[model samples]
Target chain A: MVDMISMPDDSTTAVDRALDAVLTRLAERAIPRGAAALALIRAASDATTGGKRFRPALVVAAFDAFDGDRGATPGLWDVAAAFELLHTAFVIHDDLIDRDIERRGVPNVGGTFRSRARSLGVADDGADRIGDAAAVLAGDILLYEAARLVAVADIAADQRVPLFGLLDDAVLVSAIGELADVEQAVVPGEPETTQLLSTAHDKTAVYSFCAPLAAGAVLAGADAGDRAVLMTVGADLGLAFQLVDDLIGTFGSEAQAGRDAGADLREAKRTPLISLARETSAWPQVSSALALAPTGPIAVRAAQRELHESGARDRLVALIGQTLASVRRRATELPTEPRALIERLATGIEGRIP
Target chain B: MVDMISMPDDSTTAVDRALDAVLTRLAERAIPRGAAALALIRAASDATTGGKRFRPALVVAAFDAFDGDRGATPGLWDVAAAFELLHTAFVIHDDLIDRDIERRGVPNVGGTFRSRARSLGVADDGADRIGDAAAVLAGDILLYEAARLVAVADIAADQRVPLFGLLDDAVLVSAIGELADVEQAVVPGEPETTQLLSTAHDKTAVYSFCAPLAAGAVLAGADAGDRAVLMTVGADLGLAFQLVDDLIGTFGSEAQAGRDAGADLREAKRTPLISLARETSAWPQVSSALALAPTGPIAVRAAQRELHESGARDRLVALIGQTLASVRRRATELPTEPRALIERLATGIEGRIP
Candidate 1:
């Protein structure tokens, strides 16, 4: 019955619906003061941490994938929204650390605050300081709100204990990855690109992929063994998604990228393409290509050629495909969710231009 | 029997006992690996939030003042430590926003990380990124630790309800104050010094004074009214402490001031003295006087005179005295802590300079 509307399977749609419901509640009640309300609204509006809301889709889809009555637990929606809120909080902090301003058109929370402060007649320098501080707290508030939502999930509180513990552990691990990424950029040792990607995976994949999916699965009657599979699948899928992001960051159009082309080159972000590009034997061609690459189309095209000649891009894509295959295998086994829906969402993202 | 040891009423002894226990435990723990350890240690080591252990003192004093039986609870120490942890977290993040750098001769968490990143072989730009990121997480780690500690407080879970709720509320209020301070600084408002101080009171005093002292009093069995009185006391004391700190920042000898002098001017931090100094008929004299203030003995003398003449320092001292008197009067109905011992400790700080 749940399979009829592809909308039911849409992780993005499901998460958004759930998140909106939760946010609506916050808007209606959480804060009464004008300033506090505005701060929250500003933070909630920042979608920087979220990517495609695919993880959230997994949360809802995983529940639908179950054998239980489809609409029985209306309360479960807020639970799923909780994950999205947590994800949003994570992204807020991430954007700040990345220093790549602007997300989804509006300035990220930090930038937004800076702009808002300026509008309020704050000086340039002081605005930045104020913006950053407010943004940090805004993120903190979202995190707390996320916890509050999660705590009220319809599932048996005792059963959700492990999930709560895991969520906290994941928070700690993801933070470590961010630290490592920042530290790596500062240090001289050109550690293997594998290390950088691993940091990305640790910081992102498990939580975005496995946790949300497995949590929904757990609510839907999945056991410990099922969680292990989901984690592996999620890690692979997460890596693939990140590589796609890196590719897009290097090659997408100005409006599409939401950041500068080759920002990684200037920021020295350790991307698979850059890691491979720097090591090319066609050294002069690659360097000149990198230097002359002005627009996104040109840079991406140049990067694409360099990658193919060096065989790095192919290897990276092949690696991505392999990871997706494992993810597909999990999707196939987990019939609780609409199989066609999960497949469509995952595969379709790889093809999305912007 | 409880009086046999004659514990001083000074906030430090209580805080020291609480802090020493926690740090010792932290040193023995696994530290959770990689960047997590750094995050945790940096949180524990923050000096701006550092105090003479006053909060833990307040908590204990509250317990004493309310006739809280020493033998009643198993985890009173943990309770006191929890308040201190929360207070320290507030201080660390506060300093990050202020960007003053030096706190008691050691570089702040952000500054320390930036320098150490390079020393650890991280590159300069990368180190800067790492530092900001660390400061952000370090704040979170402290916040997380405070929650964990408070969760274990010895009070019956039901009785601890107010404290639990207070802990959460404090985070929100503090964040609002922070946001306001940031916005206010940028806007260059002509807010009277009292209004400016009120922002500080809400952000710093309410939690620094009202919350911890009230938490202590609650545990010690004080009535609601008693808690209110303690808040008034803590508020003034906190204001005084902040004012003195500001004076020290602008005018103290480098040896005593630590960190960067004239940091307030550079950051445009909204301190009471700065606000007052900005005022006055001797405007150029005050401004030029500020610019010429040296980092050592001469700087201290010049700063003292400027602050004194501007009337800001005198106002602050007067406010502090008033608040303390009120706290003393309100404290009468409540059971006394070791008053003689506390008075002795207070006397020691008396002639040491406001």
Candidate 2:
């Protein structure tokens, strides 16, 4: 059903441009469904497009890799969209759960809704309540719309059947992971790093990377074995990606972090770096240094040193090296060099640790 | 594409019964994809089937009235399932918003989720919070899944083009109505009867009856003129139906009510009778009576007397009677007699108030 000849060749530059046009059209068509949907889509797109375009790029790359036609089926666009929808849903609800203010230089959906309600003369308690409720619904709708779009995709029925199931599995796994995250938040913690990593794999790796990558591969008519290879590559890369992200959130500048400095620190999120820091006894001194920072790069440097001495930095570099080697090893099993591409992205993302 | 000649006659009892079987089966297939869809689907079926089967009946009745063959494509089951799904979503979210405990003589989704979390050793506040979150997501899945099911129906693609759009419109309206209702809850003073009725009409009338009925008509190949009639009849019937339900809730015995005697009173919901009582300046006494002895036939008799003297009962009765007449009038437009059956059901439902 996905004829390779349908895709635009590398010489044709308009395919990427055409995607923007189609996305705008989709947005326009989606808005009239209702005011609430319009508001939500607007908010979601703000954060969605603000991030790195890695996910969408994967759809294009995988298609190209498999010699699958980029223009073959518009279904590829819908699949990419499905990924954004699920990802945006997570980000919105995650921001709400975490009580975040700014994300990627934009107010989180919860904060925006709350501010809007207040400007309309709603009381603070009621505003907060309404904001939470609206955010929940918005996330649900975004996720729903993504699935709906996939269902309504004008692809072969056989191909479409598995899309929703994959999506459903991703949603369930992510939801359970969120539950675990929520539970961890309330517990008087010092939870094991393994438990936390498992949560990351379920909520982050599987949904964020494996599902979308495998979806793209399947769209390109990748064989079962190819899909299996992509799955492993995706999970490994995604986990590494999250670890890097968590590292940047703590050690990087606010601009680079796209979050408050020491965010996971404040929330006491059980990121791998945090666990490693604690396991090596760097946490005690690092934690004390965080509380006693002098509000400059000097404080940041000192904390970094404490972290390194605790073996957190060394372990991270070692893990990345190991993961990179694994990716190099695994790519031999599949064509298209997706493993290489994922590693490249992982490398760029993890570079923030310095 | 909705081939009629291939359809079994609605007059064939076995054909109609088999259609129900199909609809039931469709509702039962939650998701092979994962636990969340399965959780949501199970919750939907449990909550949906436990009701009076009124909404589904309206859809079936409307379809059969046009001589629309249920077996025409077997996909009519999708339409039936969609209606129930929407209803289930609305009720689940509505109960959570309203903080009601019982729906159909069992704990609503929020209550069930909360109880389950509590049993799992989650803290009370944490459990309630998680329950709210889960219920929100679950309700959304039901609404989205309903639309998904509708799109899957093998209807004439041209006629069904706007089916999901229409459902989306209904969903947005219902959610806004929810927002408005929640906003209106603390307004203290009684709203005008017209204002209260308008709010009630948008939130409950269309959401509960008109929209579902209209959607069913769309599925059955009803013309615009036919749909207008259906909506009108459905809206009026919905209002009257809710009024009767309010009365029963306010005054019925424990066995008869199967719900709290003064649930509306406690919640300070804007029901017609309550609004009427307020406007007539008889609310202080009646409200106190409602508070003191909102149980048994004596209360129903007292409320009835108060409603009568205030001219409220007569007005409501006249309106309901007119609406029922319109339903009768519209029945003639149907290609079959299921319209008459629906009309009779409406009458029976409305007449049970005393």
Candidate 3:
């Protein structure tokens, strides 16, 4: 099962406090827009809470690794909060795109707004429209707020441009990755390995690992070489992390992953495992089972068996191992603080790799 | 009717060149991602072209009005280009949200992608998803590019903070206005006049007028008083602009407006005209016709007639007149160039006010 019980630490507490500060500031401003606007902001605020906070942790840990004099900087918290907020916005839009009604064991942003609209006695289609529109706007607002936070951050004048560049690139590239994903799933053929890898790197690796780590280093006045190294390490780790996520998504139980199991199969997602399985002797059965996925659990189970027997799982495990090793190797080249933090994250990712 | 026939002036050409430079740079980098990614960018580039370029004109005119030695600054073009890019992004998302299939007399970004998917033999639902997803990502990329352009702009360090603030606030507030729009349309009751006015200011006035004008003034190193005045003038002009737009949407011919006439009535949109009609003696007929809108064209036309005969059209004309007058009065407080530009735009709007 996914761990939700880590000991309360100073860094963790600080991140939470930063998030609360952002919400408080936004809520105060939301007051003037009256009840409807206030309700929208509150929904956004609610979405920001209760994530794994993994991205923020990476931001702080990466920054801490540089051994910068933390006392001299006032914007570290804001930067960390900005990463989490970006993640919040991404998840909100992702849920809407996926038509997912639940996230983190509760109604997601779209679902929350949909429920609210229904309670107001709107019709079914109208309620769906309201919910989707609310989620879209909430995501948009969070994105603006995130950029605003970083734009107005108390960073050195020289650092702001590069930092904003990194942030913007991450967001832009992730969107490109998301489009690639939709194209792969809908284009009526098996997706190429290159396309899948590129998508994974853009969507998960860069934002989750690369951007936050590089940002932290940049803030700490790292040189270009150091920044490049951090980016490489983050990208590798992020890809490996996503592989593990896909593994859990398919093979693990709902209780372990905090989501509906078999959703990937039901959606006919073209994961690496799925594409590789298509190359095996069990291709016919697996493809047929995928076609019958939602209505026929037996068929889906058959597909799962085919994937395992076809050695796709073993192949994915090997890839994850190699990727995580690369991350570790890169981390050792960094300073002691970052090396230890990255090593820890790598180990955590390793446990879930298969 | 939008005057799509405006001659290409120096400012327009400058904005176009900036956009072309951005596209060229992105196109170079897009080589590694293959055809799909490149096609997506091309669609975005296409969406950025052939607009009235009104926002950019405002940015340039307002900056010119400040009488900054035009030859000294290098970033005005970038800032002007940023506004157009922002507008492009907004229109893309707006089309997606409204499910509008056409824009600028052809298939929009979403429709283009949807067509691509369909031609590739994808199912109808899958094609629709592809289209919507592509539009979302395209809009997102444009927003990032806009911010990046501004962040790296060669403006003074002191000015970047406030400029970013104006940009962020406009985006956030516009999203709120969009949400208000969806809510107003879906909810059963007549929308309050206050809500309509607020939505207009937030969606149209702030971004289209106030932000551009203020941004221009700030770029030209104007004092806070001058900047504030420009914002007031912009807000008034923008609201007047939107009122004229609403009037055209209701009363103008399909050929003139370049879309299906009575679309607002068919969609049960809560324009000020609709709100006013609800208060008139024609309420029953208007409401009944609205209810029957999608089933028959006759019902839609009947609602249009009720709206006109109920005196709602005259009332909206008067409101537009009063709002435009306020715009002109505010403009008289500004420097000559912006005052003339605003007056010219005001007169253009006045022709469509009824």
Candidate 4:
């Protein structure tokens, strides 16, 4: 396992400082807009905290691999922080779409506002409505803030357009992926494996991995060939990361995943694991267990057990291993430092326990 | 009344061409992403159509005020089109927040997706959920597209930052305004007049009026003093426009308003008119009528009658007039062309039938 705690302390500190500066600037801007405005900013600030800072780490790592001077090129931190903010915005919207009130075992932006409304004597439905509205607005402000950070990053004038273009493309692709994911859930059917993988790539990989790594390359004035190599490596690592996440989400403890382990089944989310399990000898047992009120602990556990016993889990594990190997192979095109960082990140994703 | 039909033909054509180019570029970009992405781009395209193009008109007008040569400075049209896109984005989110499926008497983005889901046999709740997710994604894409247009516009490099800064400020202020507006409706007490007005200014004025004008000024390389004057004028005009909209929303025929006339009453929205009506002798009658299931036509009519008879309607009209007068006074400081355009826009807003 590539321990997350082993990330270089300076990069982490730089990202944290960049984030703090962004939030402080936002707070300063909101001071004159009144308390309601400030409250929304606070919600955004809270939502941004507590993530593992993985995306920003990729940015910093790529920048470092190019020998970009951290002190002289502080805007790289802002670029890194922009990715974090974008992730927070996506998380807020995703939670709203999923009707999830809590994230990371705490009240999310929507949950925070919902509680506030309920404490003020609002009814359940009314509070939920207020909460949804707050979440939408909160997500919106963060989204703009993210874009604003990129637009205003003190980089070489010629580099600004590419950075903005990359950010815009990431936003567009992510939204498309999210739409596809939601459509898969609503349209009753087994989504094609290819379709599901495409959704996963668009929904998570483009923004979380590809953009951040490529953005760092852009900042470092790396040639197109190197940037393309980084993006390909980023995509492979991102796919591996998401596959692990699905594994953890389905079979890991709540403490391991920081969310309910049974949520994917309860939601009837058409994940690759569920799809792969359909092809196995234990399909009947897994399907029956899932059909029997999947929200219940017994049903969830039965399905989990059947999937584990079916060899589908092993198949997925093999698939992830293959993906990581591909990433490692591709990282050979890069210099030593970035290649090592990519391999470590892939290893860390592979080591996630379920 | 400034006739919408009488907008300068050249400017209107320029704005239309700019919007078309933007939509085409988006479509081309989505070609490789497959059917789902193209569908989203189509929905965003649909949402952008059929509005008055009022915001873009302001951009063109402000640009024209400085003799910004349309033939040489075509980016002015992109700037104008960005405002329209921003407006469409806001409208999509607003409809989602209001839970309205239709906008301007047609199926909105959510409604279109909801209908599609139902046609595919999804249950009502499932369809609504799908619809909401689609709307959220659709709005997000348009919002980013707006910012992207601003970022990529072929203006002077020095001019780019100010335009971006204005766009960011407008987005931030508008979100704060929207949150405050939602809070007013959710909270139990009558909202203070000052709070309501602030919400009106923040929610509607900043993006719809101030930013578009300021952005145009930035594009023209106008002096800060002129830009500031135009912003003040835009604020006054936006306030007048919203106040008139509220009047039409409550008192105009459905045909005139292009939406259900009774929606605000049914929603029990705390508009300035409602707040002012609370202080009048008609409060008892209005309260009773509203207490009797405000969704019904009889109750809505009774409440409307009380508001009209209590002179609150006239008070709001007078407020609109005062606002228009202020806009005219401020516009006097601008160059002749912009002054005329601002005054005409305000007059058109005031002339809406009720």
- Give me the candidate number with maximum DockQ: 4
Query: How well is each residue in A1-354 modelled by candidate 4, as lDDT tens digits?
Result: 236424488788888998998888888999998877887789989999878787788777777778777666768888899998999999999999988999877999899989888887888888888889889988987887788777777777787788877787788889888888888887876888778778878888889888888888888778888888888887887788788888887888887866677677776778888888887888888888778636588888888888889988898899889988999888899888777777778867877847
Q: Tell me how each candidate scores on DockQ against the true complex.
A: 0.35, 0.22, 0.57, 0.65
The sequence of per-residue lDDT tens digits that candidate 1 reaches over residues B28-134 is 44264444455546445554244655556656766765677877855567777776676776776777777745566677777788777778787767777777787
Rank candidates, lDDT, best first: 4, 3, 1, 2
Model 3 clash pairs are: none
Off by over 4 Å in 4: A1-7, A260-268, A291-302, B1-7, B260-268, B286-305
Ranking by TM-score: 4, 3, 2, 1
lDDT of 2: 0.62
lDDT tens readout by residue for model 3, A1-354: 124113238877877887888788777767787777788889999998767777777777677778766677778778878888888888888887767778876888788888888888889998888887777778777776777778777888788888887886678677777878777877887777766877877788888789988888888887788889888998898888888888877776777666667667766678987877777787787777677876656766776777788888888888889998888888778777777877877888877653
Tell me the interface RMSD of every candidate, in Å: 2.9, 4.2, 1.4, 1.4
User: All candidates: CA RMSD in angstroms?
Assistant: 5.9, 6.6, 3.1, 2.6
Model 4 global lDDT (CA atoms, 0 to 1): 0.82
TM-scores of the candidates in the order shown: 0.77, 0.78, 0.92, 0.94
Q: For model 4, how does the per-residue alpha-carbon lDDT over B210-251 read when each residue is reduced to its tens digit?
A: 898888777777899988987898788778777877887788
Of the candidates numbered 3 and 4, which has the greater TM-score value?
Answer: 4
Model 1 DockQ class: acceptable
Greater TM-score among 1 and 3 belongs to 3
